[model samples]
Target: MQFAQFDVAAFLNAHWQKRPLLIRNPWKAWANPLEPDELAGLACEEGVESRLITSGGKQGGGKLALERGPFAEERFGTLGKEPWTLLVQAVDHYVPDVAALIEPFRFVPDWRIDDVMVSYANDGGGVGPHFDQYDVFLIQGLGRRRWRVGPVCDAQTPLIPHEDLRLIEDFEATGDWVLEPGDILYVPPGFAHDGVAVGDDCMTYSVGFRAPSRAELAEAWTAHQVDAMAEDDRYGDPDLSLQAHPGEITAEALDRLHGMVLASLADRDAFARWFGHYNSLSKYAETDWRPEEQMEAEEVAAMLGEGHGLHRNPAHRFAFIAAGEGVLFFVDGVCRECRGEAAQLARDLCAGNEWSGSPSEEALALLAALINQGSLGFEEED
Candidate 1:
């Protein structure tokens, strides 16, 4: 569904990350996507990450409850009438309906987009008051859920220590409202909030965006660079000036070393390529995305000749960035260089789920590789 009526620029300027905003029933006709039974089925799958939280203690909000899932069907029946919630992450990767929820919000850059996490809750059910390190758009799907948003929280904010979950120690709601179907709440990073199902069949789709910490960037990027660095590519000074104190490293030597380090990290080209691969890494990295049999270049050409296009796997993460004279295209953690028509193909794949244009030979090769990797599929496969 296209958000042709929504003001994208106004929302970004006013509430992207600055604060929270409530958009009441923005869609013309908002249809609930996944049913609770489907969500429960997904939770039972071993490969899918899920959680079951049965709130206990005072008002059913305490540290005494929570369980990881791959649970048996009987477990749902055993939960009883107690307040509980089921949360499944990256639902978009598995369900096309859930993935469609991300399309409307494409006003934001594609690289910034994460995944859709769907949750089902019973009356009085909640994950407890807490803050996230990433921005999220909470869209009510099935039933009513009363949400409470408090003051902004940060690193200093105290959390109730638990093995599975980190909940706020104490929270006071500054604003409370019940969200009906199609309503949306935009919560920026580090804001405290809680949501409880007003009744049964309550479902919420959380479209989240991540903010990589400085420490994370340093560790991951440095690790990538270290592996790629040559052994002889070490600190070298061709002309070293003598110093009065031999114990003290000369400023010139230190300057050369620092310059080398800066030069390595500040290589925009290398960083661009690295980031394309880095950000394209799927949340389900261990889950293989390869097709059973790789399609040949001839088959691809024939398909394109027959007016068939390319489609991206819902489970794959695809993106591209303009790098110097060419483009760096990334799909499911693999990076490829693109030029000419191939570059346009990369951009098209990133922007849309399907591609219909005639493929150049170079584009055919890249598409074949992605198809073999199981991230790109022929339109006829649909």
Candidate 2:
């Protein structure tokens, strides 16, 4: 997909996370990558996460309904019947075409490009007026939907609470537009918007951004660091006096804890590895597969020689091979260590796209290992 010719870098530098900017026909002739039935089927699966929203009236001021993750098949029985909607998150991880549509936006940091969520709405369906903490670009796909968005001014503002959805209480729309297929609307954080499908079959793709809260980052990083520490020598408190004094847990001890935290983060390589692995992991449920048993090296080499394709597992964002010494191995987006021929082989595999011609002995071995570990495999073209 050719990106809209706007200076993405400049736009991002200027308005990203600051204000919303809409670009019309960003992807000319943009197609709906997944059909409504495919999406609904995926939502019904136990591994997939999904949500449903129903609104009461045309003005969108009515009873709200919500349901969350791992939805049951029976829940989708009335999908095409009335004023309701279903949203399936992280479609790109499973659908290659959908994932490829997002590659153009890789200019934005991987950490910021959260996931692609597809929403299918029936006539007069909406989730109510609400503001997101992160930025998003809503791409119109199947049909038309009217949207109204307003700026968020206060944190303590009241909201209309449904069973599982939080909607703004007194959202005043500053902008309104009808989105047709291929049209795009950018909404920055704190923009209260409500989208109601005008037609019976409307599908929209929401490319969401990640806004990690300070508390969330601290919790994730601290847990990772603590786990790493467990593999090493334990934190020692040599001065053990049985006397229980609340004041005795002095500022110095607190400082020591802080120091340990900083020390863990100080290893730049370790931190980068963690961040890369964390972001690359897929957010959606993936299909499980078992590799063919006892495949010979010659058979693997022959398959690679015949130009078999390799796709990175949706469940696995990164793969790494350990290299001795100071060398690090990075495949897809994951990091590890490698040396000599192994390092070269890893690079070729991670270089993106399909591999032509025969795979080297080392490459074949690596691919075999990846397949065995349920991380990657060869796909035969029909």
Candidate 3:
């Protein structure tokens, strides 16, 4: 489940977000985690993000086609055998073995990690040549896949006229390779790349990272700050003076207006707290991850007394930020201010450590709350 031999520092400094690097069977003992049939079953489940891409169109011998799922179980059998691929997003959220793959790549910060998207493709099957805005490490899990790496692309790059797929008009490969099981290829953001199965039953796991655009951050931050702002908190001109020209706005007025906006947005501490919650928000926010029955403090204490371990839910996000003597622990969009033993517990939880040692009463309460909300669960429950 971990890397056999690799230089993390060197890779980050020389290749990360700079260029593509091909790693040959880096795992100590590489084993395919999810079966093709298992992945297909996930595609047929509700609330699972999935896509079916057909090269010769859905009906066959036409333009490329894209179909969103939860698809009918019979649909897979009917798709003409013209090279199609089934991609299920956030496979790690559903598969524990698949989620363990992310642990090896923890050199990258937790928040930057998006999720592991697993795709199963037949011979000559691929989603087409396209560039992603975020970085991704493509891990070949089953069968061989021929990957064509092209130059970096941007908004100006020309695309083929396909309604669903944003395929490059004429992709030129700078490097090419056929990856076997356990092999990995890291593709930086905005780089054009294409992968097609060399033979049948090819499966690839894509561990993609989140690279929020400037506009996205600005918009989200603005929305958050606005929601907290009061209507009464408006621009004021206590020291108003008559302007020489009534039609012209004075420099003094402009400065005050600009300062008002900047002052409201320049709270680094407030932004840090807001971002901790924002970043910890689950990718699948619409899907409820709460436990079937609300966990009680008595139950949590009984389990802890029995020497049961606590673990995080892979589907939920967990992060913490130091605040004075305590920490702000954010989980699934909820933030809890932890002090003393609770603070230490938060650190341990984020570090993926199991419950150990005696915990304070406050710590037990926090644990119960987390378990009740489905952010943390007993190791046996997993």
Candidate 4:
């Protein structure tokens, strides 16, 4: 599933986050990974995030309609002839082949990589003209789609009034293309674009990247720091001196107060550790990924001894950072300090490769814990 012909470094320099680029059939062999029926089936399952959008049909009565799912299995058959699209979020988490699509895009940082959202649109169907706050690579999976790219948009841009959809009020395309299977369109943040199905059975896999807003970072990071603060760690002025106006706060006092706040927040080491856990959090926090049966350390070691490798769970995120003589390994919202063979194992696991390291007792214990917690699993032999 690797790209047949493409320059990763060139794409990043020229087009990534700068503008749009359309790539035609870049894969070694382009094959539709999931069928249209299979996608519809996923939309009907409970706990799966999905949506059905309709326009100019009985469902919406000429206006755009948005319905959240897990929809009834029979609902697909009831939709009358109308432009409509079905969107399922994080499809790669549930589908293995779909998860494989992310491998080629690993040129991007793993932390910036978000889940793949797959959309199935009928003829003339689309979600309408809109812009996303994050970068996305839209891979045409089945059939053809007409995609139009427009100028960059921002918060100042006006939108057509709709309850759920944030469609642009007026769209003027600067670029247009009809993409077939295996074609990819890279859309950067703030760029307005629209895609409409040219015919039936049109599916597109959108591989999105995470772009944390400043406000969001400030809020989350501050909250995390606050939780660790002691109650007695309040502002103090032991060096206070007599002032002309007792009520007036002096510039020196302001500097001290501001410095206190800034100094606390400026702990890069603490922030890095916090972000490792924050970024590695499971997308579906409520969905438990723990395995049914916990494996013993001896059993896990034996399996590794027998040449079985471990694979990371697609639903969970893994990352690490150097800390002193070891690495702080973060996975599924939990962090552990790994040293020696355990450190090597953490690096290997985060690489998303089959774990094939020489197993030590410490490493085996870590592996058993990960397997039990559902962050890693035994790779199946072919």
Best by lDDT: 4
Candidate 1 lDDT over residue span 15-113, tens digit each: 889899888888877999899999999999989999999867567555448799888999999876778999999999888778989989988887788
lDDT tens digits, residue span 1-382, model 3: 8998999999999999999999999899999999999999999999999999987655656566899999899998987668989999999998989999999999998989999999999898998899999999999999999999999999999999987889999899999999999999999998999999998999999999998888988899989999989999988898888778999988998999999888889999999999999999999999887789998787888888888888788889889999999999999989999999899999999987356556778998999999888888888753
RMSD of each: 2.2, 4.4, 1.6, 1.6
Q: What TM-score does structure 1 among the candidates reach?
A: 0.93
For model 3, the superposed segments whose C-alpha errors exceed 4 Å read 57-62, 353-357
In angstroms, give how far residue 220 of model 3 lies from its true place.
Answer: 1.0
TM-score of 2: 0.81
Error of 3 at 336 (Å): 0.8
Clashes of each: 0, 4, 0, 0
If both were scored by lDDT, which would come out higher, candidate 1 or candidate 4?
4
Choose 2 or 3, whichever is better by lDDT: 3
Each model's lDDT comes to: 0.87, 0.72, 0.91, 0.92
Scored against the true structure, residue 152 in model 3 reaches a CA lDDT of: 97
Superposed model 2: Cα runs more than 4 Å off: 56-61, 69-82, 153-155, 230-261, 284-297, 319-335, 339-353, 357-359
What TM-score would every model get versus the actual structure? 0.93, 0.81, 0.97, 0.96
* All candidates in order of lDDT, best leading: 4, 3, 1, 2
* Model 1: lowest-lDDT 10 consecutive positions: 55-64
Please give the lDDT score at residue 377 for candidate 3.
81
Compute the lDDT of residue 236 as modeled in candidate 3.
85
